[model samples]
Target: MEVVQVLHMNGGEGDFSYASNSLLQWKVISMTKPIVEEAINNLYCSSFPTSLTVADLGCSSGPNALMAVSELIKAVEIIRQKLKKKPIEYQVLLNDLPGNDFNTIFKSLPNFLKNLRREIGGDVGPCLFTGVPASFYGRLFPKKSVHFVHSSYSLHWLSKVPEGLEENKRNIYMTDNSPTSVVKAYYNQFQQDFSLFLKCRAQELVDGGCMILTLLGRRSQNPASKECSYIWELLGLALNDLVDQGIIEEEKLESFHIPKYMPSPTEIRIEVAKEGSFVIDSIRVSEVDWKVSNNNEVNKAKSVDESLKGSGYNVAKYMRAVAEPILISHFGEEIMDELFIRYREIIADRMAKETTQFFNVTVSLTKPK
Candidate 1:
């Protein structure tokens, strides 16, 4: 599959769409608010530009699409008020793959603008929102144009699946059982893609501009550790179940692989040092429970089994919303319902035995003047 062409969060606001199932992503965004605020503040105070340009790379469609932009705007407004500075004109760029639901983000703009006006009023400058449909792994903006950049739950995605993975067999991603060559290939691809990403962004960002990025990561030095591999391993098990029942072709499973890699914190720092464009301001590693949810009152009433089952289903829906497009591209859409059903059961069974969480890495960087 063409990663650029095929990759995107599930579009629109449906039960299974990314818009409806992005609580974990939202939590990551919220968790990194202070870092984002500091970056925006630092950038603003550096020059106090009359016009500030901010770019949200991989700004997938959903309530979370404009979330970071909103934070940046609020941050700028607060600083302006504190220093008694003039209004700073805002240029916000929302970027993602061409297949992203730009329409969904656009549809919500009226309310977004209305709320911004009500909250900040005339003190806020013109906030121009533009959607740039392109890949962040390459240049998407002009040189020295963007003042601040933010991306959440992106960057783990490789520009494409690594080459020479035919030996990877039934796995869709790096697994403990993967051959040494497979592991090396994945890391090599990540290093190549991330370096190019830094180079492109370095060109796009003005001197002393700031960028904050949050992505799925592995705490373990081992790329095959459960932190990053278990989720896909379970999904692979679900696919294997289908193959055993003659529902999917074994050869298809062998050929299909996800174009994503969860790097470790050490790996991230190493890349930043190697790239030589940005200084690493801060790097934070945190974990969010795989069973992330907001349904507290309802959960209190359910039995242990009921809660576990509900958690499994919720996690399945979240994964489905994120992975459905890629899976559908390779496996066809007919088996989706059944695939996720099996996936839910497998997750529930696993959760009954142990707690699982996603490792997140949030990094703050700055271009030296």
Candidate 2:
């Protein structure tokens, strides 16, 4: 039998799109910037090189990539100013899937450089900006060429959907009420994708190089019951609801699946250890309060109600509007509205009471000596 490829916004193109929205979350960005800066400082200090080569894996097209790279440049400039030494040349690499929207990123580059020029006031050192489109799971650059690698909100995504999610196969993940096949299937896929990611990243980093990864993670090893607890399940249910309502055909709904996985901190540690190329430097966990829109309670409630009523395509418009092009490409326009309504109900009814809506784990790893 032929294998079916499930495409959802997870690791490849979707990672970048999701990141675009995530970057707008000022609270999250503010908390993450310092950690990233500290990691860069540590790498620079340990390496003791005047020039630095940095790469942002899974960097999507838009201000987010520029924002991250700019922050790194600023951090390095501050260090140089304090030392009274000339700023060193910086090579910044922005990487994403081949299907990523580099046009948007490329268009914004000139503006970013202009802003940099103004900020440095003719004192800025050499900087090279390059766009690389490729999967992070494989070699994108020459071996040992990268000095610092930074990835945020990207690692949780799996390279591909787990094998054996077909109707006949037994699930590999666990469930709250029972050891159902559904949970088992998810667990198996998560393990495979995560392992491959570690192996690939290990080959890319040079000995002593540092990698700082920040992504959504789970605190508990136990399985969750509600579909909203997992992004993929939430999306699946929404699509199912659309099919049931005759908004979309069953064929289209059947083709949808989340391509990523969210793992616990312990699982991450275990996977990294298996690679045998990196040592854990530090692990920091923080709450990530992600809100779809403005935090105004009245407005939020109103939107929620509108979404559930399937009024004015508000539900589908909200999700599809924010969704990456890759997903839109797969699902097309037919299911958009239904998906929105289903998603709204899931969020309002299931996720509203939860305080720990989302959590981020920042793991700093250094290539082994």
In order, the Cα lDDT scores of the candidates are 0.91, 0.63
Question: What ranges in model 2 sit over 4 Å off?
Answer: 1-20, 23-27, 120-122, 167-180, 223-228, 250-255, 292-330, 349-356
Cα-based TM-score, every candidate: 0.98, 0.81
lDDT of 1 at 268: 97
Q: Can you write out model 1's per-residue Cα lDDT over 215-269, one digit (the tens) per residue? A: 8998899998999889999999999999999999999999999898998999999
Q: Which candidate comes out best when scored by TM-score?
A: 1
